[model samples]
Target: MSKAKKSEFRPNDYVVYPAHGVGQIVSIEKQEVAGFELELFVISFEKDKMTLRVPTNRATEIGMRGLSSPDVVSQAMKTLKGKAKVKRAMWSRRAQEYEQKINSGDLIAIAEVVRDLHRSDDQREQSYSERQLYEAALERLTREMAAVAGGDEITAAKQLDEVLLSRAA
Candidate 1:
């Protein structure tokens, strides 16, 4: 690191990267690239088993953010319980939109994807693509919920499923 506490983020901070889900700032490191010293935030995604090095200067610009507040999380849960909004667009278009929402790293938008794509026990079966997208959104949402509310992702996922199930019935 160029200096201690050089950026808004610090070691051990859980942050959300737009393309990825929740990750922790493992450390700030300085690496030499093309004769220039670059200070980077080393973010570790435990669920994905991946590590990404983001330049501290561009972290905010790249949509790296702290966890959503409790109010925001509550809103996401409420969204999950709301009616599914399936647009009239073709499957390809809808899939693209859902993919964007999952990658955008906005909690509510991600929740919307999960809600819209969810299927109850009696609902029609989903195509492979639809199932993939639905799982992606649920994974992201659960991870964030776990990070914010203090529990494992499995518990958070179960809670979210209950919310969706009640609405579906």
Candidate 2:
């Protein structure tokens, strides 16, 4: 294992894999692959019902990171309460941007997607694509929130929804 990744992450830690949301590092495995011995971090995603083994050396390069600190989560919640910035671009372009933000593994960016796509009681319903993107962003944000705050995803999601809905009112 590289010196950098040797102590960067540990088993039982909650990490955010850019494309996979939150997952737990179950263990570190040393295995021979293609005639070379490799050290891997085995991550399990309960929500996705999947397991991912990432080479320890490549974890940082691929944006595998620890959960956001409480301060950062607070900032993201503040972002959720802020005004939504709807762009004048086409849905395809906007969707691409939202996906990029969500995959950036930044809690505040994901929160922005949730804030903008969130529909208020008086607002028109979201289109199918918009709803999909919104749900994706919400899931990513809430999962991180739950991991950081030490509770379940459902409670975390409800707390975020309360923040958004209260702001709308």
Model 1 bad stretches (over 4 Å): 1-6
Candidate 2: clashing pairs of residues: none
Model 2 misplacement above 4 A: 1-3
The per-model lDDT (C-alpha) reads: 0.92, 0.93
Residue 128's lDDT in candidate 1: 98
41 in model 2: Cα distance from truth in Å? 0.3
Model 2: per-residue Cα lDDT over 1-169, one tens digit each: 4457478999999999999999999999999999999999999999899999999999998989999999999999999999999999999999999999998989999999999999986899889999999999999999999999999988998899899989999
Writing each residue's lDDT as its tens digit, candidate 1 over 7-110 gives: 57899999999999999999999999999999999999987899999998888888888899999999999999888999999999999999999999999999
For candidate 2, the 10 contiguous residues with the lowest summed lDDT are 1-10
Error of 1 at 142 (Å): 0.3
Model 2 root-mean-square deviation: 2.0
